[model samples]
Target: MSGEDARALPVEDARSIAGVPDGFGRFWTPYRMAYIHGEGKPRDASDAQCPFCAAPGKGDEDGLIVHRGRTCFVLMNLFPYNSGHLLVCPYRHVSDYTELTCEERVELGELTATAMRVERETAHPDGFNLGMNQGAIAGAGIAAHLHQHVVPRWGGDANFLPIIAQTKAIPELLEDARARLAAAWPAEGMEK
Candidate 1:
């Protein structure tokens, strides 16, 4: 569909969108942010001016990066938990589900599984929290493109910092995580 057509479709009120109980009656959806509050003016990079999009194929040398593959790429979270935290974003910038094809969805799933397996090997977390924040109302910092976040977790991983002070304490930096994950990128059948 054309971007204008995508913009014209009706979006459910934030209060009605499932998965966020606190968001109900408490937040404005991206649709509301644009159409109602911002007077329909574009809020994103001019369809081609993304800070991340402008980034090089190898990603920043300071290292919030993983493999930049044919379709999608991964980046280490500047902030993280239990070592491995990454976001997988498509090379093409598309905001919502309607824009992704069946193959893109399948590839995203495989990439996520691979991320999980690599994280399990690299950090040995007990489990994980795979998430996607769809729009601003859903806490998407970069809401223009739908991406999957793979956050590795372990039992008792949370400490007094995250619980009492509303803060997370990640020991290593993004560069460290990038180097670590990059070292493991060539695992046998990793692309399977």
Candidate 2:
């Protein structure tokens, strides 16, 4: 068809005329734009505005915290890539892993393990992705503070949405996830 004819056609007709394949779906996730624009992000990397530094001061629900330890804590990811996504972070505001003290390092590891256990109990994910992005160059959204991500993965969880539209559809609310994880957290060995 000519360019003028294509422009005058309805969207569906235009697609058909262009021989575009059918049966594709669109998942609109406009909310993700906030994360892209850094809405609710700290103004700077300073402790005064750092999310990791401020989260501990708030109550569990407000902070989306699932567990709290002396040196490190577990909190829900505000912009989770998947449901039950959590972050284990030190109480201190330090960007590099080397900046963590021995106690902080140990607690961070323990908290991350606990986070995985709790997520498994609560969400029953088939697998997990755990690691940290060190700096801005390394994809750390908050490069001022160090945090370990614990993202639960299930079969067929990977899809075209994130790749095609840069959007992830989280199936649960953060509060609900926090509550479920907190309730499932092992109580026997948890630090006060």
What would the TM-scores of all predictions be? 0.69, 0.82
Q: Model 2: which residue pairs collide?
A: none
TM-score of 2: 0.82
lDDT of 1 by residue, 13-60 (tens): 333345444532322223334333434232573556553454444445
- Residue-level lDDT tens digits of model 2 in 23-112: 454444556778789765665557477878889999999999988888888999999999999999988888899988999998888888
Lowest-sum lDDT 10-residue window in model 2 = 21-30
Error of 2 at 3 (Å): 33
The residue pairs found clashing in candidate 1 are none
Off by over 4 Å in 1: 1-42, 45-49, 56-60, 187-190
Residue 101 displacement (Å), model 1: 2.3
